[model samples]
Target: MKKLLSFCLGILFTSTLVAGEVGSDCTFKGKKLSGKVQFVTSFPDFKVQIVDSFPDLKVQKVNSFPSDCGKWQEVTSFPDFKVQIVTSFPDIKVKYVDSFPGVP
Candidate 1:
């Protein structure tokens, strides 16, 4: 009985550890600039998608190491539509979001 209990506990602990590991890809979906640009467990801090409108610039989240998210011009004006950068993820393609507005 003790062995079975210990095995169950070990499995539970292992699953919890894996669940705590941060993911490498995901996007945000909601109004831009409405909430803090913070990391959520389900979403990758390194990538996000603004649903209501496009942010003028996109930034990537780095995990304690230097990252090359690239230089993005700060978004001073918010658009009125949702946007997703289909060509890239986890890295900031500076001009990618800008192309969203011109999509025909």
Candidate 2:
């Protein structure tokens, strides 16, 4: 009861935060992120291993959707594209990979 409520609240907060990110060009929108991710070039770039994940970043050579909602799963290797994770106030960062795909 309490735990479930708390979990739901936490998810709600995270979802809102992800959606409230200003100037965010990412098309994926979910309470959680799925697929394996990797930084392209020591930079904040990240790449996931799957495509069914929510909110596909809309980058070529990768299997991502656009502005959706769901959970994020982690993979082992050979991700789809590059991405950055901002665990602070914003939760995540998908900006740097917006216009520039295949960057790592």
Candidate 3:
């Protein structure tokens, strides 16, 4: 009985750890992180921080065709998502790259 209880506890802990991993599917909290993006100062859909390394997602700024994961097109109007740049307490951390933009 003790062995079975221990096994169940182990499985529960492992599942919780996996559930906390973010941006694996280019989405965070059910919101897609790709497509046309807008930078805002207030009331953003997501708060982001730019980091040099160990990013949750590697982003590539594109002029057009921001279709894939981590590809973002900057736009002023009708944005698919809005992000606020924050130095601290960000929802996600990202790094800008020229190539290979996706979950790291």
- Candidate 3 lDDT: 0.86
Give me candidate 1's TM-score against the actual structure: 0.24
Candidate 1, residue 79: Cα displacement in angstroms equals 16
lDDT of every predicted structure (CA atoms): 0.33, 0.39, 0.86
Judged by lDDT, which candidate is best? Answer: 3
Task: Give the Cα-based TM-score of candidate 3 against the true structure.
Answer: 0.78
**Residue-level lDDT tens digits of model 3 in 1-104:** 99999999999876644323455677997878789999999999888889898888889999999999999999999999999998877878889999999988
Model 1 per-residue lDDT tens digits across residues 20-55:
211232122332322123333343333433333333
Candidate with the larger lDDT of 2 and 3? 3
- Which residue pairs clash within candidate 1? 28-49
Q: Best by TM-score, which number?
A: 3
Q: Write one digit per residue (lDDT tens) for candidate 2, span 1-104.
A: 99999999999887865523312333233322334455443453433333323333333323454222222223346743345544443323333233444212
Sorted by lDDT (best first), the order is 3, 2, 1
